[model samples]
Target: MSSSTPNKVPSSPPASPFKLALCQTPVTLDKEENIAVARDYLMRAAAAGASLAVLPECFNCPYDTACFREYAEELPAVGFKPTEDHSSPSLKMLRQTAQETKMFIVGGSVPEIANDGNIYNSSLSVSPDGTVVAKHRKAHLFDIDVPGGIRFKESDVLSPGGSATAFFAPEIDCTVGVGICYDVRFPELAMLQARELGAKVLVFPGAFNMTTGPAHWELLLRGRALDNQVFVAACSPSRSEGGDGYTAWGHSMVVDPWGTVLASADEKPALVVTTIDLGRLDTVRKSIPTSQQRREDIYRLQSVP
Candidate 1:
């Protein structure tokens, strides 16, 4: 792997000093087509020496709320076999592909049908050996009424995830935090990953709309990185079609501990790959001591209402 020079373009330098890939692509209503695209991107990312690859939220189905009920699926059993045209092909294939690639895979977030029959926006992190190492249900669902008259009431059809989840990826030599699309807007979740779970890198597979993506996507990502002093990777869908003209802002990105945009893909169907220097995390943390400098004692002194 070649060393990544600062602010350069179109060059595959070494394995990012520490490397990860964000698979940013557009999805239509076709689940099989999305699976095929996901498989191809995983191949591309693995070939590029990325130890981890992240896809967008609800990659297997359209981002519309109505689609969840029809598209949601049960978690596959151990050694569960899926038919060629399985209704939920991406989840099955993702587990299989991670083992096949021998790389840690963050399978983004998908709409899953829980045993209770409630649909959930879930994210899965698989080990190289095909084990489901970590799973995060999106704690914060996207329930908003945009100014454009577009509305998304995730609770209408999907149940919210109750806890934060992170997993250790031996490839990166640290615990990795996980989040979904709307979760990026909540800093406490990121803090739970970094402060509570001691995650060195935080991954959020998002599909923010043009309404909020431009304004909050990068800002939320950089703020998490800067405040937490950890690497942040934001993956987004390239398109959306539902709920009164919703459009996704598709600039998937990787930010370093210093909040620098190491690599970012344009608003199109593409992949953003970058290296994270593990050493840089230590250096930044040592210099700023932001994580260590927090005064919980002082905050506790605030008068209780």
Candidate 2:
């Protein structure tokens, strides 16, 4: 069996559709440099007519398991509040860029310091008006010893999110499901957003290593989209050499409801843009009706043996 379980599919129809942009870029040690790169890519996405742009996980810092302390920042206040002056400079730049672009931006996953001084890997969605629409803590920590000998104990420095987050995007005309890096490995979280929250577009900000990305990245993404009949998009941080002492397999992609890889970025700094047709989602759902064709009677609730 795979290390993680698959997400569940929703038993309903999509309310709407939207254009998406996937920003795939390399992270740099210099905070300002990284922001500049992200801003540039985001502009390209906006120019390409994407209503929303999603960034990669830890786009602001190295994805090293050990650098969480040096890079972590306190969650900004409710509004356009900036991270403290001494806080991560990347946070300030992201907030400012979102306001300027007038486009909804999902600031992939970042290291956030909670009020209680505990650190959590978190993601935030920013509206064009600069309001923080949704804040999602990563539910499934990337804690595993990969078969190739790579080990990631994300739980050591971060706390898991207690609930799923689904938010409305006026531009998309539908709700969105939020996820980060390793969270995509758990399909239950995706199902919670698609089935319970009625999200049509599932967004994930991820950084997978070459060890696993080549093996499971695309498989997992296509599986989720096929099962849920909803669009799946992921922004991935580009590989780097400095702090992480690790390399990321940056195959950022956008998959359609029919499990098609509509667009993808292959091992480079690039912008992936794709148009989502909501009507097609409904068409597929009607044909398959997997959500409604349930064997609920057979899979009845039962206690663990």
Q: What is the lDDT of residue 115 in candidate 2?
A: 81
lDDT for each of the candidates? 0.77, 0.78
Residue-by-residue lDDT tens digits, candidate 2, 155-233? 8888887667767776557678888878888887787778767788899999988788998999999998987899999
The residue pairs found clashing in candidate 2 are 6-187, 7-187
For model 2, the local distance difference test gives 0.78
Q: Which parts of model 2 are misplaced by more than 4 Å?
A: 1-17, 77-91, 241-244, 300-305
List candidate 1 segments past 4 Å from native: 1-16, 76-88, 240-245, 300-305
Give the TM-score of each candidate: 0.87, 0.87
CA lDDT for candidate 1 = 0.77
Q: Which residue pairs clash in candidate 1?
A: 1-14, 2-13, 2-14, 16-275, 18-276
